[model samples]
Target chain A: MSAPLFEKIALVGIGLIGSSLARVIRRERLAGEIAIATRSPATLARAEELGLGDSYSTEAATAVANADLVIVSVPVGSSGAVAAEIAPALKPGAIVTDVGSTKRSVIAQMQPLLPGNVHFIPGHPLAGTEKSGPDAGFADLFENRWCIFTPLPDTDPQALERLSEFWRRCGANIDTMDADHHDMVLAIVSHLPHIIAYNIVGTADDLETVTKSEVIKYSASGFRDFTRLAASDPTMWRDVCLHNKDAILEMLARFSEDLASLQRAIRWGDGEKLFDMFTRTRAVRRSIIDAGQEIDVPDFGRQVVEHPGAVMPAAKS
Target chain B: MSAPLFEKIALVGIGLIGSSLARVIRRERLAGEIAIATRSPATLARAEELGLGDSYSTEAATAVANADLVIVSVPVGSSGAVAAEIAPALKPGAIVTDVGSTKRSVIAQMQPLLPGNVHFIPGHPLAGTEKSGPDAGFADLFENRWCIFTPLPDTDPQALERLSEFWRRCGANIDTMDADHHDMVLAIVSHLPHIIAYNIVGTADDLETVTKSEVIKYSASGFRDFTRLAASDPTMWRDVCLHNKDAILEMLARFSEDLASLQRAIRWGDGEKLFDMFTRTRAVRRSIIDAGQEIDVPDFGRQVVEHPGAVMPAAKS
Candidate 1:
């Protein structure tokens, strides 16, 4: 479609994010040679079977050899190890980046290990579904999604712009911020939501009076919405909770305090208070839709989209 | 197409659920005549514009004067008033039902006010979108969703069966349980989720560090899932919290306790513990999908379905 942006690009950790990158890079002709690497032999074989990349390897070092760009897509906890493995093999001018949820931890884990000759950038693409693994990825996974880059103070502007261009080509809008600010923003918007979802699901599962069958059967009322976030990859979330500890803890405390106030309002039968709180949160959803971050239809338009012609719109008189 | 189930059916409160009932009743030819009633003249006029009913009235008594079936779809707090208004005009052998989230309170509010000759069955069709009002309704809102009826001990079997048949024709499966058990079950499955969602969004909104712009920009990461529930009808949710106070308090207590333990796990960096909790919750989602209560596609298949041909599924070798 267009000239390849790089002579070669290596993708480490061929999970949902990595596999999606491979698909997009291939479709857009972003790389002349796409190399994919993962620790799991089965996953590597599966990637090769799907023809996701020009070369597949179980070793990260072998995959990144002579690569003009190296993108690591793994759990936050494994960032350091992958950085150590690929550091020596990376080309001098290669741009290295990551797709971990937490940016500060990723930077701390990989910055020192990466060779000084290469430009290292910590990034998080705020996009994914509950599903995981190589097969779960699709080429349009990052379409219209925000991919935030928390670059180092001494980071090369030219290299940063190049990587931004690369992500823009993959159908992502780019935003840059400080690593600490990125963690705080994500704590409220991403980490805390996932934690709350997992906690609620666990609570529902552990209930003695309410049968599990009943919970599942009647989930459409509201509980099913939380289940989607709770079903995300356990290993990935564990790393996130561990890596972004300070910001996540701060958010949890604030959330618990707010819950206490809400609980008290309910106990006192403060209908006005409850109604006020419930009414204000609605404007945020409206803002998100207006900003194009969310779908504009009701219930994410699942009912209408899932079964076309099943739901007829209101009649015109 | 089929024999009319009722000679005249009166729908009180022409909002999301009521309007949906109107659409489905007309589509399935379930009612010979559909009369719509609401306290709000604007909503009644809108329903009339949409041709959702054969006749429209502002007074519940006028709408149900000779109707064989009357369905009240209003906030739980208004159930008693509606019951009082329509008690004198209810037909001798009519069946009356209300679709409210809190069943025990609805029974307490309306059971004594309703006329003795009429069969009053307190029902809750566990179906809705975040959006409300008559214009938001579609014919398939109840399709494949559950409709739980908490009938009184002296409820007539024929009345219950006829009402269940009406719901089945509207494409909902029927379940019956004691009013108390229904409250407890719904506290966990529905009320708590909405309360927690509302609380978290409130927390995010109240934050001083993270800008509102940042939260909306990054909402797709996970926060947007909670926003859908938080954006629900405030008056309806407030009424639910007030009416189902005891059961909701119990569930909220359990949710907070569970959340505290999860916070501790994250603070202590217990990856194994965090991983286990996150992994177990995934099964609940799977069971929900298997039970036919939820869609099987990822992210409710929003991205794929919204932009058909935008996403190419993983290549098959």
Candidate 2:
């Protein structure tokens, strides 16, 4: 293996993303020493028990001391608080980054709190499972996913390159965009979908005529797909919505408008309109596949591998 | 391995579900002879070229003649017409079934046209990919999926058992439910999801600020999942919406109400409410995973895999 990417790395908030990073860093020897910290004492204890770091602490300032690199993987709402806690202890010229889903809000929240000497680049790794917590992480979680960075105007180029290199070794392709652009892109791609999913699942749950058990049993249709996204970390997504308010609301308004039109088409029995919209949307799936952003499961067997707790009897071959 | 389940089995359509059933029946030797018929001459010719049937015909009446089982796999709108066409030729005591997604509509449309002598059993296999056409099917599509049969009152128990046996041979577990109940269940489980997916994809497609390429490029987050369901056969889905209007409208109303509430929560910055709703939805996904309906991709790789053409590349591992 090549030499470690950083002499010492500090991780704030060792949840699914943080723990996964720890595992990958350990597996690939990406860090000489790993220091882990989380706001929750119980989570910190769990991380210690899992041996996810060389040192464990509840104090973010202590964790960042002497660290060459620091990653904040908490909910977007907590980025500022963590940055404030670690700002004083951050070593001069240390590269600092975050893995929040929304970029502009995170940058706004963290930039003012961080020391001027350190690189405070905001990023989002376009990857995650529905499961959270320290135990719900794996080494390959970042493999083949996109990691987008939104650096500030005065951000050091050398620091940005080093952070990009770190993500590259973590099995991601790097893309850089302005914070607002990233927020808008993610609002359409990620936020809106999750919001829609949460809405639909809640709808099904609130049904009086159709029982929940029936929905669960017959979910093989299309509902099951949305459930996976709907099941994402509640705290993180809640913060995302609150933090990226304008972009999400804009996308939601657009989505609601389009949905009203579709509802009209269905109500009016306009087959051609429905068919055209359905046909056009299919090409996007093909493009995503070509980009290598997902796996092809001929059957449900492959799904169990990615979610170990999701084991089911194999279909009789 | 076992005696052919039927001396002759006629398939009245050759689309995705129809062709998949034909392939499985052929592979399992569940029929001594397979006769395929569809409204379109081009599709009929293609099925013959693909060797999806032992005999091919354009006329539904001719195809059902002397057949012990006739499986009508046409769109729901055409169910009554096909039943009318084949009623006179259906052999005495023969089991007539369908693979329509909306059971109540299929039953309502077909029952009146069929002769009392023929056993008209409406069934639906809860298995399909987004792709359509005879070329999109495979022999193992039905394996481990549920095939629901909605039998009318006074329907022959022996015929029902025999049809269930046929589905079992095709590698599906048999489920029996009333047509109305099945329609309501599917409205929530299958129909609404597809409608929502189609609506959202249309919404993304019509965005003025976000380019289509940008949506496709970053779809790995959540939008790609919706595209898979939206990419389903337009004609089939359109027919389903028209035929199963009441149930779908009911579900849509409930969905819209729930969405309004979620929108209110987001607008008011009600983090607790958002967090609770998001948290509750997570368990349903777990139930779906427990029921073996979906695969769980880690933090980054959660793309839909229903259409072969839409299979995204697996993230770099």
Q: In DockQ terms, which candidate is top?
A: 2
Tens digit per residue, CA lDDT, model 1, B1-317: 65799989999999999999999999999989999999999999999999999999999999999999999999999999999999999999899999999998999989888889999988999999998999989999998888999989899999999999999999898999999999999999999999999999999999999999899889989999999999999999999999999999999999999988999999898899999999999999988877766666677665653443223232111
- What tens-digit string does per-residue lDDT give for candidate 2 at A1-317? 66799999999999989999999999889999999988789999999999999999999999999999999999999988988899999999999999998888888888888888888888889878778999988887777778999888998899899999899888888988999999998999999999999999999988887888778778887788788789889999999989888898888888777777877777888888877777787776666667676444333233234344435645432
Superposition error at A52 for model 1 (Å): 0.6
Residue A264 displacement in candidate 1 (angstroms): 0.8
Clash pairs of candidate 2? A127-B299, A127-B300, A128-B299, A128-B300, A129-B299, A144-B316, A289-B312, A289-B313, A292-B313
Candidate 2 chain B has its poorest 10 consecutive residues by lDDT at: B300-309
Binned by DockQ into CAPRI classes (incorrect, acceptable, medium, high), candidate 2 is medium
Tens-place lDDT per residue, model 1, A97-163, is 9999999999999998999999998889999999899998999899888999998989999999999
Stretches > 4 Å off in candidate 1 = A305-317, B305-317
Candidate 2 chain A worst ten-residue window by lDDT:
A297-306
- lDDT measured at residue B99 in model 1 versus the true structure, 0 to 100: 97
Q: Can you tell me which runs of candidate 2 are displaced by over 4 Å?
A: A1-3, A296-310, A314-317, B295-317
Among the candidates, what TM-score does chain A have in each? 0.96, 0.94
